[model samples]
Target: MGREKRIEYEGAIYHVISKTVSSENAFMEEKDYRHFIKLTCDAFSKYQAMLLSFALMKNHYHLLIKTEKANLSQIMHEINSKYAHYFNSAHIRKGHLFQDRYRSYLITNDEYFINAFVYINLNPLEAQLVEQLEDYKWCSCRYFEDKDNAPRCLNFKEIHNLSGIEIARITQFIMSKVSESKKYGREIKEHNSEENIKKIREISAEIQNKYGSIVKNRELKYLLVYALCSKKFKLVDISFALKMSYATIRRIKNKVEKRMTSDAMVTEWLSEIGKVNAFDYQNDHKVPGTL
Candidate 1:
């Protein structure tokens, strides 16, 4: 069987989709996600590829990128292979991590280019992994949102020139697309679905029992807030569910955000609890009386 040709050339733009084999979560933990992001940045630097936008979902990722040189094949190979190596070594697994060759569509026209950009940015929200685009910290959406400190890997100037749309209008355009995608997604009808909210409470109670002696209430509050936020629950709803005031919920959320940004260990256990809760939910496991 002849290998499929990747139409490569200097200055070619493409929408690339990479998936994991058997729908396994390629990035199940925060550290794994961070490592992949670092490898992606390295690959971009190595190949001189211009990343317009990207979103890293659990089992797959979407990238809107332009090649500065005809090196898409080399770039993808390096990124995927290196990440697979790291994942295999860390997880004690073997064999192929990626499903197959990455799927890519050439962005030939301006309309498709803009569509690809917005679509990539909306992946997390559409998958119900996040309530909003900005909430997904791993995405390049932040680069577009924060113009003053825009990413060097992402050439906003090139995107602006190609689309003839100013940077000032980019956020609004992306927001509109996100709003449209959410309409179809609508995965979580309410911020606090009763079942999931109950799951959150159960997870909290379990954590409190195990770590309550050593952990302070303030730290626990930070954990709860961060975990709920990561699960796509609204602050107001989390406040109501956890019996905290809106102001307190917001404060805790901010504290956790700052800790995470500063790479502190504050509420790291709580985040682990959140991951456990998610795993439980997926496996339909019961926790004590919660059954």
Candidate 2:
């Protein structure tokens, strides 16, 4: 069987979890944690996603994300791929870093959202990694009290609006334990029901379908490079896919970035292609849960 298709849409919230391959420590030192966090912030900004909360464990990490666009896969790809590249280079290692594609649970309502928030913050305590949630240096719990020092990627205001919990009370709420039953099996039934939104289309295919032949269209080729890069496709992989040289791919990407600022038409074209690049999941089922 093939992997399950991820359900994605604008404004969708998810509890995303990714573990290192073979349960190895993903963060070997303080610098590792800092670098991962920096990469995460950059990815969020580049993809226009909002991070509500996060907890980084030794082997695994949890993230509560509310995507403003239907580009969760793209966002995660950038973060994971970039971090894996950095980690492998820093440690003089190679091969896969993560065990598999990250797992995500759709959060459909405020109740489940709050539950996930608390659940993520409590991971350290549940694993006996820390006696106090605030003492966990890697989690977002401590940032609730020190917003000025928190990563710019974290959206505490959105968290308050969605969870209906005030920013000031968030730390207190997380510290208070909820029922154990609420923690497990709380994800909705629709999470298990899979429906094909659309088959994954390559950047070349999308460009060809939208703009016809690109053999002589220099602008379209640049758009292709931009779209592929936005999806976190490596330069070498893109070169193979487009039958272009590595230097040409980088040149096209640079050109696209420059054009985006000065050319409105170019910017519009890229924006339209971005929507095409995002996963579109049509879900009508009501998510059941209560606080």
Candidate 3:
């Protein structure tokens, strides 16, 4: 079966998660985690994603984000690939550092967002990495506490919306949680099961880079081919000219034309990138036409 289609909606919030490959720890040191955060910052600047909250753990990481017109898959790939490259080179290791696919749960309701925020803030505590959440150095917990290196991750507006808690109360709540978790103990289990079942609707809107929103894929492919082709043709005209599925459209854009290409071209190209293997735009080395 084809890879499951990820649910993407405009202004959608997501709790993104990923673990180290083979259960091997992804972070060898604190510096590694810091580098991962740095890379995550880079990805946010490059993509159309907005960070409501984010936290990096020892074995796994979490990102509570809101996306506008970007694909989550591409965004995660970019962030993970860069971090992996950084970690591998730094540690002198040579294989996959993270699991194959990152887990993503789209958050469309306030309840889920709240739980996600709490869970993310309390990750270190849950992992037993630190006695208190704030004690963890690499997490949104510190971001919420100190204003330094913040405003990049924490969007206080969302926090302010919770029970009319202004920035002051927002900080108060977080600070209070830290102290409460310390006093009452971080061992207190925060239940997200009920909130996770919040009603969320799935959406399917196409937003290609620089290109406008496209609903159909067949024409998408035709346009991709046309762009690569020396042949001059209008997208509007082509859209009406041939009606094709969006997959065909995406395939066309990716230069995937099984019958159109010669056997030699097919063999050589397929050998490099077949059905199961394709160039990952997330990786600079895997990009086509780049030396």
Steric overlap count per candidate: 0, 0, 5
Report the poorest 10 consecutive residues by lDDT, candidate 3: 198-207
- Worst ten-residue run, lDDT, model 2? 192-201
lDDT of 1 by residue, 1-291 (tens): 986356678998888879999998898788897888778878999899987887888888877789989889898998899999999999999999997788776664565567677777777766777776677777777667776654457778887888787876776788787655455234323321334445556666755664462135665557756777877775654664577787887877777777676664554454455545433543223221100
Candidate 3 lDDT, 199-236, residue by residue in tens: 11001111132233334444333334433232223222
Poorly placed runs, candidate 1 (over 4 Å) = 147-152, 178-291
TM-scores for candidates 1 onward, in order: 0.59, 0.63, 0.58
Candidate 2 vs 3: which has more lDDT: 2
**CA RMSD per model (angstroms):** 19.7, 17.2, 16.5
Highest-scoring model, lDDT: 2
lDDT of 3 at 144: 58
lDDT of 2 by residue, 1-291 (tens): 996557788988888889889998788889898999999999999888999999999998999999989999998888888888989999889988887678787664455677788888787877889887678888998788888888789998898888788888887887775564144436432332112112223546755665665676766667757877876655654664466787888988887788768777776666555554332323222221111
- Off-target runs (Cα >4 Å) in candidate 2 are 1-4, 180-182, 185-291
Flag clash pairs in model 2.
none
Clashing pairs in 1: none
